[model samples]
Target: MNQQRIDGGARRAVFAPVDNRARVDAVVRRIGDAIELGLLGDGEQLPGESELAGQLGVSTVTLREALMALRQQGLVTTRRGRGGGSFVSLPEVPGEERLKARLRGWSTEELRDLGDHWAALSGAAARLAAERTEPEDLVQLRRTAAELAQADEAAACSRLYGRFHVELAAAAQSARLTREQVALQTEVGALLCLVLGDGEYREEVSERLRFVISAVQDGAHESAREPAERCVRESTARLIALRLTL
Candidate 1:
């Protein structure tokens, strides 16, 4: 037999026994969720393929297929050396301008819906962070606040503001909660940048950042939730008003 034919036949033989799309998709989603929630950080090693398959209760072939999908989505990378294994790839955080462009097509109602979701999720995060934050996490939170205070340019301030929320979510120490907060922040950040791309708005945002940090530092969980929630509501209102003017 020709070498090409032999290779094709072997490939067919290898995969001919497995066919479970649902199982593969489920595994892929579980792994993707882990990545989103920072349970698996960038460049971190993953368990061996067989081990992961066993842990997830799926066949080796199904697990391999799921991993291939993750690789396609830029979520994980695979290597072949003795020390090499699958490693998580951090998803790129979108820039403020790029995010704003993406939100240009959203209707006013859609923006309101997003704001509502953000308020509820962020309020919960503030409450949880106040309750669960360790001293080290609080220190990181303070550092983020300092960065916001020292930012001299609008673009730089926007980026730091984004990081501030990410740090607060991390302080909560719940992967699921962090993921939800990150998603909401992404949307709200985009909208805020779109509506308030001026010096005045940047100052307002900076003031709000100060209040949130002070509340958290004071260990007043309920107090912290109010500023975070108000920020979302006010930003949403600003976006809606700008859209109306346009």
Candidate 2:
């Protein structure tokens, strides 16, 4: 296995074209989410402006604008003169208090609805992966689950947790599903740190993630869906509970 091939699905997604309706924001989000999820490494150089614009089906002007926005957000850094280009700069995860304050802005109903959508996407991805993917194709999924289990902090755990589902969708071989999972994670993945921060619950979710992987590898599509959905539902329930305390 080529080491670089790991999580390639997400890398492909990060540079894929934007929705066009909001091209600048879309580019910022696609790249930003990839950085936050660790799909792109710190200090990794991005494609040149012209090449990147071509890859993303955007104009050079649009790409430059988006890059400027990323620079302002501290997600990207640019160098001048020879060998100059945009580089990834991973942002630090918010402190617990900041995370709580962010979570407080979401109503319980909103969290529930987002969870439902998340469950649907994850369940469908799991089922498709079981039916469509080879066991060997699941190495990335297994690797992500293992990483999640060993992750020492809430931020690391949340990134690996979200990465697992994204890889699951990738294993399903549905580019659209993969992209949807990426976009969805940018919205909810960080908030996951709030619940996954608990050691006990994190361990439980890790086990559930392993079960999801096992079912997919075993070709048990139906069995794969339940654990995936349950994991999301449990996490969402935890978040909602925490929100009430705020």
Winner by lDDT: 2
Model 2: pairs clashing at backbone N, Cα or C within 3 Å: none
The Cα error of candidate 1 at residue 161, in Å, is 1.8
* CA lDDT for candidate 2: 0.85
The residue-by-residue lDDT of candidate 1 on 51-139, one tens digit each, is: 98999999899999999988877778999989999999865754343334334546789878877887787677787788776677778
TM-score of each: 0.55, 0.64
Query: Lowest-scoring 10 consecutive residues by lDDT in candidate 2?
Result: 93-102
**Candidate that would win on TM-score:** 2
lDDT of 2 by residue, 1-246 (tens): 565775587678778875554888768767775776577999999999999999999998889999998887777999989999999986574556646655765789989999999999999999999999886878898888888889989988988988998998999899999999988888888689889889999899889998998888889898889888998899999999999999
Off-target runs (Cα >4 Å) in candidate 1 are: 1-104
Give me the runs in candidate 2 sitting further than 4 Å from their true place: 1-94
